[model samples]
Target chain A: MDQFTLNLIVVGITFALYIGIAIWARAGTTAEFYAAGQGVHPVLNGMATGADWMSAASFISMAGIIALAPAGGYEQSAYLMGWTGGYVLLALLLAPYLRKFGKFTVPEFIGDRFYSGGARLLAVICLIVISVTYVIGQMRGVGVTFSRFLEVSTDTGLYIGAAIVFAYAVLGGMKGITYTQVAQYVVLIIAYTIPAIFISLQLTGAFLPQLGLIGTHTASGVEFLTKLDQVVTELGFRAYTSDSPNMLNMFLFTMSLMIGTAGLPHVIIRFFTVPKVSDARTSAGWALVFIALLYTVAPAVGAMARLNLTTTMWPAAEQGNALDGPAITLAEIDSNPELSWIRTWEKTGLLGMSDLNGDGQIQYFAEPPAVTAANKALAAATAALAAAGPDADRAALLAEVAAATAARDAALAEATIGGVSLAERGWVGNEVTRLDNDMMVLANPEIAALPGWVIALVAAGAVAAALSTAAGLLLAISSAISHDLIKGSINPNISEKGELLAARIAMTFAILVATYLGLNPPGFAAQVVALAFGLAAATIFPALMMGIFSKRINKEGAIAGMLVGLIFTGVYIFLYKGWFFIPGTNMLADIPANYLFGISPLSIGSVGAVLNFAAAFLVSGMTREPPHEVQELVESIRVPRGAGSATGH
Target chain B: MADKSSANAYWAANLRTIGISLVVWFLCSFGLGIILRPALRGIHVGGADLGFWFAQNGSIYVFIVLIFVYAWRMNRLDLEHGVEE
Candidate 1:
């Protein structure tokens, strides 16, 4: 069967499974809506948490980011490190304590711990900001996956996704979101691994991608990394395994992501679904285990995809296959059945090519701006020499130009397989300017000539990942509005049934808002997620930590800390990336040259967190101490004894 | 007889364990994985250098182990101090 129909069947089956799980696990009360009645098993909760935590960024974008390293260094490893490391912080420092607090939402914990309506309101604002920013990315991801696999318009794809999530999440609440997420985790992991295994076997004669990454190339018998290093460097880019140019930025970026991961309200609330404090800790471990199954394989997928992409454009004749004889020409890319994936992606406008010198050959290389300038300068010099009198040593000047061109050309020829230059390739500018890095993974199986079913599975997996995380985030947003805002504050006397209705309404509103943003996404929705992580790391994380770990931190201090942290991180990001990310409204140019203390906006959250700690401590020193009862509450939460049941108050 | 002193002792033990475990976690990701990565560059494993391995894979492994160890040891401490749930 063709890919589109197969994709529909696979995606349809997964959607039906999700809806079935949602109906079976439907929430019956406000508590179930908020916390799944707190009866979920540790392993199950862990799997759900994995699904919630690994958003579109984790599934569709992360490996591509790590692989492309658009920043041209290994700095992207920070995502790999920081994201998983946050779970460590959660499991040890935050999750058990929060679970013990027996709360419905993160803001409620802050509200109760601080003993102030103002503090609770502040926490709610922060949660909404972080979650809303994050949900946009998930929504955009859903649109992309829908558009690609289902062959619908981005808007149509988004509405379909929003409708599916609305059905499951509104009906099931936390219970629905949790069980569906488990199914998603299973689907996403299998979908992720199958392709990696196939590609690994083809590339290195190893079935395990992790082992394959470190193994030798089956055809060339060279170690994979060594071959990769040689290939990328030949294209004038840094070696595949090289370190980032700025170590400090990488460190801070990783730290921020880790802290942010721990503080995300949706992820933190997952631990509350499990029964006991110890279970929260164990669930985090299980979550990490499931997460690691993909995280560990991601680098292998990244490296192998990078290798495969380059090799596809520049076939390796040394392997001596019939298709390995020449670099891909523009005409062949359009006509060759083997090159059909390129045509499919090109229609999305994410991939494009041009024969700048009219050479009719695709020249994929690095430092295009530099090469173009140098080539122009050489041509001009040669022309001027020819324009000079015949007495001028034109022969020598021409020879010098020829030699320079040959040297430049030699790199591509030596680095690629078969050493064949497609039509004197050196003068050609980089053929493809619109090679969207995000398309790498989705296009990988097709590039490697894997079977259509595996490609269909990838479509299902990407949608599952985006939907699962979107459901979790929508749940958080709805709960915050219902549990923390309306029920907790506006109408304390609201009935349980009334609150459940409010929760569903809140969820529907959140989905509509998310769908609208997904349709007209703020530029590069994923980058906005960095701002979300920053906000969470800076404001929410410190507040939660101080509320648990310190008795002296008063309500005034917590509120002050959150405001200071939020403004600090928000302004820093806005100053660099536009004001509220409105494109051209940035105060400073978004470049490393203008960064504060050499810290990029991506890494500024760590600094904001430190500033929060300092501000909270300093402010608390000036204010009266927390009330005696609040102090007692803190002390009680610190221990695991007599942890109250999550149901029936 | 599990009064304030015993409660205080239990908290102290938990804090101590947390402190030590956090130290190990820090060393694994930031220390060995990033700062000390350059020093370990010559040490090869599979296809990557030791530092790259630590950054991409080893630190995560260590984090999972650290959390489980913290939970198990803290549970034992809780029992010793008569604070088990």
Candidate 2:
């Protein structure tokens, strides 16, 4: 069978499996719907959490981002460390205590802990906004995967994805999502690792990508990173191992992602499903083990993919003679079987090339500085020629033009590759113009010439990653609406059956909103990720940490802190990313020079978090302490003893 | 239930463990990975320096180990303090 049919069979089977799991594990009560009946095995819950946490961005886009980072990809380690490091915080600082709290939702814990309906309502709003924004990204990722693999329109793909998530999430709730996510984790991890293992064996003669990353390339006999550094620097990029110039920004960005990861409602809620506080602790470890399996391989995949792409463009680079040889010719690109992946991806419009010098060969190199200077001189001479008009010193002007042309040629000659002038070789500019970062992972197997099944598995894996996270986020949003908003406050008299029904209705409504947003995706979908992470890091994380760790933090303090963190982080992001991400509304350009203390909006969350902690402490010190029972409640959650099933009230 | 003084001691031990673990976490990720990276330029790990390895790979391994260690130690603490579920 062809690639499409293979993708269809693979993706269809996975979809059937998820729907089957949903049917098998259909939730029966408010408890089951919200926290998977509080009976999930630690390992299985960890696996499910792995699937829930590693969204399409992790599976499909993370390695790509690392591979294509303009500054040699080393600085992108922020993402690698930041994302996983948060699990450390989760396992240690948050998970065990939250599990012991025996709550159905985060807002429930916040409301009761703070002893205020207002605090719970604020948390519900924060949870909804964060999860909703996050789910939209997942839906878009699903659409991209389906459109690329199944040949469906993005809208149709989104509707199909929404339907699948609705069947699983709305039907089975957390129980269904938990089991399906375990299966998803299995599929995605297999899909991710198989390619890396194959590519590792192909490139470095090491089957293990983690070892292969540091191993010597078989053909070049150079260390993998050394070869990568040499090749990329030859093409005018910084060395692959170069450090980021702004250490503070890197620090804050990593911190933001770390805090954000721990704070995300969808991820935190997974802990509530576990049987014991101690189980919650180890479950985090298992989740990290599963997550680390991919995270460790990702850098290797990125480095190897970059080397592969660079070598494909400059075939001689593999032999350590790139400068002495010609770039890949258009004829070879057109007819070489190994290069067919380029053409196939070109059809998706995410990858493209243009031959500006018309030499029929792609001269993929950074423009030499001399050529830039020469171009400037040529432009000046041309303007002078035009200014002379028809009468004044026409021949002199012509001579000036000739001199400028000669000068440009001389400069081009001085700028040589392997002592051969670019002008002599008739090469002008880079040709591989549009390499979308997503291609690094999605097109990876194709680039390595892996089998059709592997490619199909990748497609299925990307869809699974997207769908699993979407389901998890949808569950979080619906539970917040139904459990926190409605039953907790709006209708204190609501029956358990009525709450379950309301949860299902809220889930359906959430799916509709997510699908609509996915279909119409605001132009600022990418920009709003900063908002999701920022608000989560600034507001929810601080509140939860204080609620569990500090008995003195009162409702007044918690409310004040969350509001301060929310508005500060939100407005800061809006100032740089446009007000509420609306186009052309930014007060300042989103650049380092304009940043506060060189902290980019993406990194401002850490600062917001610090400010939140300060505000909470200050306000609490100035105001009355939490009630005696609230302090005792804090004391109780601190221990692992007597933790029972998740309770609504 | 454990007495208030025993509870306080348990909490302090837990805090100490967390503090120690966090120090390791910060040292690996931020110290060797970022600020102290240049200082460790002489120590090589395969192709890159130890700092680069820590940043991209080693810190994650440490984090995984740290969590399991914390869990194991805390489990023991819970049992010793008669707080085990």
Candidate 3:
């Protein structure tokens, strides 16, 4: 069978398995629907949380981002550290305590802790906003995966994805989502590791990618990273292990992702499914183990893929000499079986190439200073020719353009690698123009010439990653709406049966909104990720931390802190990323020079979180202390004893 | 239920464990991975330096260990303090 058939079979089987799990685990009551009856095994819950946490971005885009970074994947370590480190904070500071609080939703804890309905409503708003923004990305990822692998329209794929999530989510709620996510974790991890293992073995002759990353390259007999550093730097990129130019921003960005990861409602809710606070703590450890399995392999995949691409274009780069080898010729790209992945990706418009100098060879190198100056002169001469009317001085203007072109060609020919001039072979500017980051992972197996089934498994894995996270986020949003908003305050008299129906209705509504947004996403759908992380980091995380840790933090303080953090982070992001992400509405251009203290908006969440803590402390110090009963609640949650099944009251 | 003083001591012990674990966490990722990276660059691990390993691989391992240690220590503390569920 062809590759498409293989993809259909693998993806179809995964989908059937998820729907079957949903049916088998159908929830019976609000307890089962919302918190999986508080009986999930810590290990199983950890696996499910891993699936819930590793979205399409983690599975499909992270390695690509690392591979394409200018600092040879070093600058991208912020993501690797930031995402995993947050679980430390979760397990140590947040998860066990929250599990002891024994509530169905995050807002429930906030509302009760603060002893205010409005505070609960604010948390609900933040949860909804964060989860909705996050889910849109997942939905879009699902659509993209389907359009590429199954050859369906993005919209059709989104509808299919929404339907699958709805069947599982709306039908089985947390119980179903938990089990399906466990299965998803299995599929995605297998799919991700198989490719990395193959590529690692091919590059370094090491079975374990973790060891392969540091092992010697079998072909060059040099250290893997040392060889990668030599290859990338020879092509005008920084060494793979170089430090980030801006260390402060890197620190803050990592902190923001860490705080944001802990604050995300969907992830935090996973801990509520376990029986005891101790289980909650250990579950976080297991989740990290599962997540680390992928996180540790990603850098290896990135470095190896980068080495592979560079060597494919410049075959002699690995041997410490690039000038001796001719660039891969266009004719080889057309007929070489190994280069076939390029053609497949080109159809998706994620990869492109052009023979600009028409030398039959496709040169993929950074332009030297002289070539840049020459190209500028050529552009000026060409423009002058256009300005002078066709009737006047046509011959002279044409001659001037020709002279400029020759000068540019001379500059290109003068460029040297390994002290050998490009004059021996006529080459021009870079030809591999558009290598989108998504292609690094999506086309990885094919680039290494792995089998069709491996590629199919990858396709299935990407879809599973997108769908599992989408379901988790949808559950968070719907639960906030149904359990917190409607039942907690709006209709306190809502029966358990009535609340379950409301939860189902809310879930259906949330899925419809997500699908609609996925189908017709706002232009800034990608940019709003900063908004999601910012709000979660600034508003939700600080609030939860303080609620448990500080007895002096009264309702007024918590409310004040969340509002201040939310507005500060939101406005700061809007100032740089456009108001509500509308293009051109930004007050300042988003560049390092314009950034406050060189902290990009993406890294501003840490600052906002600080301000949140400050505001809460200042406000609380000036106000009355919380009631005696509230103090008791804090003391009780701290002990982790007497924890019971989640209840509304 | 335990007396208030015992409860307070248990809380203090938990805080102490947390304080120590947090120090390790900060040192591994932010300290060694970023700030002290250049200082530790001379010590090599395979192809890269100690700092690169900390940034990409070592810190993650430390984080995993940190959580399990905290959990194990906290569980023991709970049992010793008559707070175990």
Fill in the DockQ of model 1: 0.67
Q: Give lDDT tens digits, candidate 1, residues A1-649.
A: 7788998999889888987997888776545655662677778877878888887777877787777775543577788888899988998789888888886678888988999988998898899878887887788777777767866566777788788778767865466667888899999999999999999999999988988888998887888887777776666557778887889998999899999999999888777657788888888899999999999898889888888888887776225332334457988888887788887777655578777667677766664444556557667766777687968887888887887677545543443312434234444456776776667778889888899999999999998888788877887887788778887789988887787789788888878777876676553444556668988999999999999889999999999999999999989988987765555688998888999878988899999999999999999999999999999898888888878765422
Q: Give the DockQ-based CAPRI class for model 2.
A: high
Model-by-model DockQ, in order: 0.67, 0.83, 0.84
Q: What C-alpha root-mean-square deviation, in Å, does candidate 3 show against the real structure?
A: 3.5
* Candidate 1 lDDT score relative to the true structure: 0.80
Could you give candidate 2's per-residue lDDT for residues A1-649 as a string of tens digits? 8888998899889888887987798776545666762677777877888998888778877788788877667788988998899999999899999999887788988999999999999999888877876776677677667667856555676777788778867765466667878899999999999999999999999989999998998999989898888888877667889988788988998898889888999889878768888888999999999999999999999888988888888889987956657788899989987788787777665678878688888877766778877867887989998888567898888898899989888887777754567788786545776786766787899888899999999998998888788777877787788778998889988887887788788888878877776675432232234447767899899999999989999999999999888888888887886764455788998878999989888788888899999999999999999999999999999988889877666
Model 2 agreement with the true structure over B5-80: per-residue lDDT tens digits: 9999899989999999999889989888988998999998888999999988999999999999999999999998
- Each model's iRMS: 1.6, 0.8, 0.8
Please give me the total number of clashing residue pairs in predicted model 1.
0
**Consecutive 10-residue window with the lowest summed lDDT within model 2 chain A:** A521-530
Clashes by residue pair, model 1? none
TM-score of chain B of each: 0.93, 0.95, 0.96
Residue A401, candidate 2: Cα error in Å is: 14
Two-chain DockQ for model 3:
0.84
Q: Candidate 2: TM-score?
A: 0.90
Taking every candidate in turn, the Cα RMSD to the unseen true structure, in Å, is 6.1, 4.4, 3.5
TM-score, model 3, chain B versus true chain B: 0.96
Stretches off by above 4 angstroms in model 3 are A151-175, A318-320, A367-427, A491-531
